[model samples]
Target: MASSTPQSVERALAMFDAVADAPGPVGAKELARRVGCSLSTAYHLLGALTARGHLTRTAQGYVPGPRVPALHRGYQRHLGVGAGVGELLVRLRRATGAQAYYTVYRGGLITVVDSTAPVSDTAEPFVPGPEIRAHATAHGKALLAGLPRPVRRRYLDEHGMARFTDRTITAADRFEAELARVRGQGFAVSVGEADPAYTCLAVALPGPRGDGSVHALSVSLATAEFRGRRGAIRGAVARAAAELVPEG
Candidate 1:
């Protein structure tokens, strides 16, 4: 049986979808009516999701969170850039035998927009939310490298390179150099430092605008499996990006 907390969360999720699927913003009263819940219950749920950036209020009513559209774009990026990016990730995950992730730049931070973990002993899923190391993760580095040089310097200066593991690169200059190389190679790699015995392979995806801003995707897995299949993993991610990215 599902716990009460999960049940409440599920109902809240339904309420958000009901409001979001509407043609335009929906009023709390109408939303509650549509959700078949009391007005108070509806407001409470909306307030919670809104607080967490999963929903937002508008003059018209309430709408999906900003993250929602970006997530949609990441999944469907192969078809067109408007939305549906999650579907692409699903396909990539199935093809790659590793965990796949999508991220977008938000408030100068790289937020994990979505992810899919392979069903295997080698796969270890990182709980999705805000990434602990936006500066260290392969997706984070890909996004960072796409930034202007000056902005990159400022970020490094402000967040002063912190180490996650023995192998994590913490020197600002070295990391800057690594970013330059990533830009040249068109992909990023993180080995065994972000998490012990795991490696991440990532690539920055071009957006609709010609600017450096990007949508990034990465595949992560245990070190041994990652090393054994690195070439294939890299090729799969590259192909997915080529298919999904508007510029590609």
Candidate 2:
């Protein structure tokens, strides 16, 4: 059985998501309605978040705080242009003619650290969400499969596999089997799993200083286009990962 999520943490995260999705600063009453909590509870949580610098209050209402930008800067510093991953992403994009992304698994979250793609008028750029769907994305699966077995099991128990598309692996046993395959293959591929229109291929990057953390490189393209050149795309991605991340 999956462990229950703490209500307070759930509520706080819901409120934060509401604030992030809003076009402008949100007042307490509106936030309460969005989070399905009482106005007082919303106010209390908002106050706490604001004090902790997760949010900022203004004449309009509450907006994301300075801490948000500071955190982003810190994340970039952790994986900066000097890290050579940026240039690797550019090369991957050129090699595959698809959007190339560098993703890292940190604090139990899969974050897209950088991406490179063509400047096309027709193609919409891929925007990664704040909460990664680990069971669906190729990079997410590659990263998850790299974790220690116990830690990976704990993560799946805490965050139950939520299905995003019909192709998403929802059964725990089946997902475990998929991770095992990824470990054996040294790469991962997803076909219309996260989004029906896109296919993604990814390979795990070397862990930082041999720590157990997970990082990966991925390329995403339209399903039909990916099908026509799957082998070439996979080879390019694997070669890039191998060249950029040194052997431990």
Please tell me which predicted candidate would have the highest lDDT against the true structure.
2
Candidate 1, residue 101: Cα displacement in angstroms equals 0.6
TM-score per candidate: 0.64, 0.69
Question: Which lDDT value does model 1 have at 173?
Answer: 80
Candidate 2 lDDT over 14-122, as tens digits, reads 8887887677898888888887889888888898899989889888888988788777666666643236777888898999999998777766666777778543433
Tens digits of per-residue lDDT, candidate 1, 104-191, equal: 6544555676678643434454534556676677887888888878887776676666788898888878898999999999999888
Error of 1 at 154 (Å): 2.0
Residue 45 Cα positional deviation in candidate 1, in Å, after optimal superposition? 11
Model 1 TM-score (2 dp): 0.64
- Candidate 1, which segments miss by more than 4 Å at Cα? 1-82, 118-125, 208-212, 246-248
| 10 residues in a row with least lDDT, candidate 2 | 119-128
| Clash count, one per candidate | 11, 0
